[model samples]
Target chain A: MPKAPRAVVLLGAQRFDPTLVEAVKDLGIKGRIAAITAGWQEREEEDDDLEEHLATLSVTTENLRLHARAEEVFRADPEFHKAHRERQALLRHRQDFYRIRLEHALDAAQVIRQRQAPEAILEDEAHASIQAIRDLDHMHLSRCAIDRGEFEDRYRPLKRPALAKHRSEIAEIIAGSEGVAIAGGHVASLLNRLDLFGIAPMLGGKAIFAWCAGAMAISERVVLFHDSPPQGVGAAEVLDAGLGLAPGVVVLPQPEFRLRLDDKERVQLMARRFAPAVCLAMPERSRARWKSGRVESQQGGVFELREDGTHALSVARHSVPPMKGHVAS
Target chain B: MTGLTPLAITTLMMPGTDARKVDEFLAGKQFPLTEGPNVTFVWRGDAEGVNLRHWIYGLETATALSRLPHTDLWFLTLDIPEGSRIEYKFEVLRNGKGEWIEDPRNPNRARDPFGANSVLQAVGYEAPDWSTKDDLARPGTIDQLVFDSPSLEGRRNVQMYLPARFRRSRQYPLVVVHDGKDYLNYASMKEVLDNLIHRLEIPDVIVAFTDSPDRLREYANDEAHARFLTEELVPDLAARFPLYDRPQARCLMGASFGAVASFSTACRYPGFWGRLLLQSGSFAFTDIGKRNRRGPLFDRVVEFMNRYRNEPVAVSERIFVSCGVYESLIYENRSMVPLLDATGMQVRFVEARDGHNWENWRDRLREGLSWVFPGPLMFVYE
Candidate 1:
């Protein structure tokens, strides 16, 4: 039997989109894949447990990776390392100062606890914890070496090696596979960096699959909704860039049943706000597949957002014909 | 202040007797009753076979008072606004005349902030449900269990609520809610979970409601509270139940002070929680003293966001944030939601119609839960 294709899932701040599983299954792949979480600072024990869970889920463990970008090495260089070390030392010192301040706070808390009862103590503990972390984060950032403008520029180069390594490993896993599925929202960021570093030509002849943030990142432009000054990452920064691998803008997965009626309205508004961008809104557990730019409903129905801002939904039927291709100019 | 005089009077009514009943009886006797700071009555009563004019004022709040006759009236003049409703009870003298009574004008009553009992009325707002009965009595499947500060036993209350399809044997994702009383019961959180679970909107998950009574003092101080959770609570919960035994299966949630706790805890510990639900969090409280005195907590929250802006966060840990348009803290919550998202956390922002009350918090629970547990619905039939 042929070795199954391997995939990488870049989780968003929310839960994983279930449609990725279906997309993978449809691609005739049956192998364990790695789920890489890239955003937050994690506790060691928790990180270990998460790795164990993903491994249990059959994702390849040997190659499981984190975003240990080469920037750390650059920052650690002797010339730059001094500034970094000094900043780190300052952060550590400030943290210690705050910890002492907390002793006074704890003492006050004890008095309140004595008067109020056990519950008061619990509330006090939670308050103290939140304060300490907030203080620590503030202390660390005030001492960071890079400014926002310089940081963004420098950050681009730093991402290249990480993406190259990820791609090479993925290439090895899916050596002879006809198609590969890249599940996750952050995958687009990796794809974009790959194109920037001129690594896209290296993985020729392989079909690409993307969903949620993964799909959004691979499109002509990845829309950053969560960003205040909405950012758009282009094909160079977005790895899949229609990958010529598929067509049409992938509507990332969202929630199906919104708690508030306004939530649906907000999502629709987002789609409208990005008009002519071929906005695709995939609800949780649902998916949309694009072949050669023409979108088709798969598992989940496809909703076409017209230029007039009106949306049309076509339900999924067993006898539906496969969608044709249309190039995004 | 001309009429202000220190007066002392003690009245008693029979136990278990409604004070209002006596007031009604006195009303029929053609006595003049005036209620201000207390209930005062001037009535003609026969004393030793001679008719005498008597005055009575109820200074204490009582449902029942000891019965007495020939009461001596010690009247104190007090300046009170007209139409003001006060609560008081009358005291009887040695002469068997006056008895304790309730204020007729103000039937509603409330507890005074001070230790001494006084007369007042209920503010007409609905009181929180303090009844400790668990309507859903069966032990719920443990999705995630966290125990913080084991050495401080009995000081904490471990609260657990199972999703609609909860079962004893099945392991589920655990979302731990800080300020458990406010989130689970006071906010009608269980109902939100039930609706989401039943609709297949969100995946089946276990919710551990951790009590945080001293929230203001502890949550934002030293992460000692988070340590209690990560070190103590997680271990204790894991051992006792079949919860999702991994960090990816764990989540943390809170609002206001609780919100700061949830965000700070997750950021500090990172992979410990896969999801975070924060509503009207005070993210901007930068200076603790200033925040405690006059500044809103949002100042500190902004400091937290700026610091962690580029830190590698649990990119996989999803976050849901909501705030009422009328709530003063909405701006902070809104700004933090995107900040967390920019740092690579999955974040959903929501705006509601209400304020920072249980009603709005209750509504956000279902939406927030669904965001964290989006997957195929699994129903556990009892």
Candidate 2:
């Protein structure tokens, strides 16, 4: 039987959006697929949606739960637990400082947006404002990585027997399955489980489909951003360093909700701040596929932010070539 | 506000009843229910000498009914708005207690997160059968478009609701709603429109479910958002669809900040979008730029609202404002009513007892749509 090429497929939100199912079916695999849904917290077994989708294609599924089994890790390794707590505390402190700087920079940007400053002055102010935010993010993200790495190096939590049991179980599951489906939720929770179990190595280059926090977890860095929330304005924070799987892009899921994409200054600042890492806007139905370490298709209405505070669709739509223009300050 | 008189009287043919004849009345005809433009809602065996009002239209929306002529049939023959789907319950003063009870006879009901309420589709109003998916009916098509906005310098996916009877050749009234997905999914607007258009309650219109990439920043009376709607989107829509060009045929709508977006668009582009359907709008404003003390999220929103208040410009020709009585922003919406009414624009204000939610906005859709786009067939009895 002809099979789809083994690859990593990054998708948008899948709770309501069934793009993941479509991607999984397109893989053309009849074998059982392992699933990671620790990100969903306690309600991990509620895999009815994924199950329903797979049932249509007649694919057997194995929903691997790291969340339900995290108690073992905590129970066995007291040192790892302490280290993890310290690391979380440090991360929180780092976030507080980052937030202060972010707030200040955002205030400056708001002032700049409202100001009728000269073009040169406006550009300078905007440039500095964006730089400040970028510096803050970079510093925070770096600090988080160092802190987590130090904890891991000191504790060697992955080597703990409690987690070792889960690792063997996950490895066995992945060995049988031709692919893996990772659903999104709490990104930290998802990453913690994935790292604890160390299932990435067991994948053996099998095809993986992930979306939302799942996609964010596999990225180089997981950024949490929301422009306006119910309580107040929200600043985008680099949550933590992700598993270096979906390389080189800030996966901003629900861009429709979080990003003020319409605002030139905000969008432009975001583009420049996250320079090099293509800040990919993944709303529902957005898709980006990586085959053999190469991004093959970013065609499912995927958009990439540019340096000049403008975004263009990664794929063409309705034969209308991508609109290209730098935003006027 | 203009007062309306009942066009016709509708009498129940069943036997007259008091508390003694309750069983007989029950066996004969369903009490507390009537049909017509002027239909009396009867509540059997009510104890008088207490504050009581018939909860009509929506939750907490009530009217006092006079005891019907010569019987215990407590009835009020109200000439309801020509085309309206009203929800009502009885507040009976019985056993020294006043409690609300749904019209047991009326089978039509609508439920939200709160609870259920009995619905009344008036003579001219037809309850959308498509509100519930019917296999027999041909469903309307919803074409999703990822529009690259030139004005705002971004891309947003808009869900366009084209009626089953849609044709490119015919110019249709255009209704642009904010929070496209919420209305379509949460509010079940596609179903409502499908049924409405199917039954000819509303005209076959082109609905552009325009979503906000960032709702708070854009919809808080933001200039960029206004430009995006009027400048970027409108022209794009005109080129694509057979849209009615006149302002009268164009409706800009939304709820919460979405309402602010529609209103701000109307203020910015006065002659462009004339029909406004604002549901539970966050018309946040402060005098002399004194911020709302809540947070800075609404600071700019207040600034814009104040600007509109200071310079009260005639935004639209006809406007329908719906809000929930239990909402925190009730004052804001209520304040906007008089402000809008004073602007020489036809303004209709409606409210329900429920809190601010998608369902509250959803229930107001039929009333708002029918009034805004009554088409040529619906006679305007002024």
Candidate 3:
């Protein structure tokens, strides 16, 4: 495996209007940039607009086509494909069971937060409630790890000729590229392709730029969150362990559209529940760069959620470092 | 006075008030003046007789608005329930011939295919912000799917809503909407779907928007129409697009007669369509006598509803039924909810203050779609 990446830059959703060119310029990345739009699945080849946009900066992009390669591997080895399918089903089942507990724990936390009581007692109970949610998240992630570990142990996917051939090609692309740009789409599909090809090992010692689902996939943990869904009370749950490229951060993409930030209780609850790891809310035009296991630089009104409320990154910069001390729950 | 509710208009109704005071009261004040549950409607100009014509069931259809003693202002105040949204027009009598016109003072209007009506939102009612197009939300594209259906013995054109960033490898849930054109034109279906999906309120799914050539006959729970949707359209769509084959991912939705078509279609192929969203269904059923008072159009609708009520089988896994309290079909929709729930299926029922119109159906789309096919908000992390 190569050395750790020089830096990892995460951004908001880039579908409607992308600020990727601005981010790329800020990083001073020139020459060929390896692009992974595997999350786009069958439409992975349809990156004309993205390619044109990058061409303006005089930066050529090479799509890794991890999704297509994964498909090829599956076709070549039906046994590995069946095992992958079974693993996905197991993960889904785990998530379904996890949600039931997560919801109840969140509900209990909310109730305690709202209860009319003395401030000191309320603070204690609120912390306890948040801990319960954290415990549930930890438990869920651990179980997901077990499922993934079992699959990897049984199949030993990297040893297989089908996946090994593609991995070597992808490694060659990364070796020749200045930086890697991962675009967002279906997060699960994106993570699945990333995991199957084992691209994390090759991502070291290069500048990495990812946005939306891409940002979440590279983080320490993949957290699915929405404060106000149409039906039922939405509780953010741990999907699985991420690529761990950008450690000590839980990246929430498009928070301006997903989260009810004005609600202090919900904000505080989310921040405290995911304590140690910085919960970053990346809205449109937002950018955050991680280097040396800390937030090196950030732009836009990117928010760092706290126990009181969400503070802009300018005022909350100090909180991101302690996040590195405790990377996992 | 600019923000005064209709209940406060009594001060202007005093006998001593002159035209100057009335003009001052009218200047810049939004109408119909809504204060709590009381809404005061004001109409300006001369007429032989003026009446407030509204489409609210169980209430007087036309209530005369008395003209102030010395002013041209005609005012009528009524106690409208909080959270109720109603559409009304002023019936101005000119030379013994009545002409119905939208409110001159009320700027809020709801447009339908026929025309537009003045909108009155009571105290707690607010139009959903998500229904409007947002520049930030990525818009979904609509494509036409033309096919020949042997079941209907004709060619059918369906407009498909492929969500932004749609992928062929990902299998999406399917929502087949009846009366598709009306939903697109009046309900703002595309905008709502785009916003809802962008906001993670509902999953990014493929929508098959279908319209009938002969809506009255075909949407009356006709057997051929059911076959056309289940046997023909669905198979073609599945073959063309990457859609989930499971019943849980399939849904059938419509409003009024179109709603009847969705319900009957799901019933015919039980467990095939797992979700049903029926809005203001024209379920005119007779508990005792077989008399149908809703005219010839409702003859077949009443027959299907009556038979379904008697059997009350579990057709779908989940059913979301909504109706306007002001609509004549409210009683039927309300009664059908309990019967549907009794079938051991998940049932959700919602009621609004508005009448049977496209906007009312449009307002319920978010809740219906989200509840049926909840998005990544609840489950998927990436």
Per-residue error at A82 for model 1, in Å?
A: 48
Number of clashing residue pairs in every model? 94, 2, 2
Look at candidate 3 and give me any clashing residue pairs: A4-A205, A187-B382
Q: Which scores higher on DockQ, 2 or 3?
A: 3
Question: Which candidate should be chosen as best, given lDDT against the real structure?
Answer: 3
Error at A324, model 2, angstroms: 30
The iRMS of the candidates, in order, is 14.4, 19.9, 3.5
lDDT of 2 by residue, A1-329 (tens): 12223788888777675876678777787889898888876667888888888878888899987887775566677776667656655665686568656777788778876889799998888778777777787777777667756767777766778777777787888888989988887677687778767666666558888888888877777777666532134566676667656666777887776678777766776777776667888888888887644577775688977777788887522111111110000
lDDT of 2 at A62: 90
lDDT of 1 by residue, B287-341 (tens): 2333433355444555555565435355345778888665667666676666676
Angstrom error at residue B40, model 1:
35
Using alpha carbons, what is the TM-score of model 3? 0.75
Task: Identify the superior model by lDDT, candidate 1 or candidate 2.
Answer: 2
Q: Which sections of candidate 2 miss by over 4 Å?
A: A1-5, A113-117, A306-310, A316-329, B1-382
TM-score of chain A of each: 0.45, 0.86, 0.93
- What is candidate 1's lDDT per residue for A254-296, written digit by digit as tens? 4243112134433343343333344444555555554433444
- What's model 1's TM-score? 0.37
Q: Residue B251 error for model 2, in Å?
A: 46
Enumerate the candidates' DockQ scores in order. Answer: 0.02, 0.01, 0.25
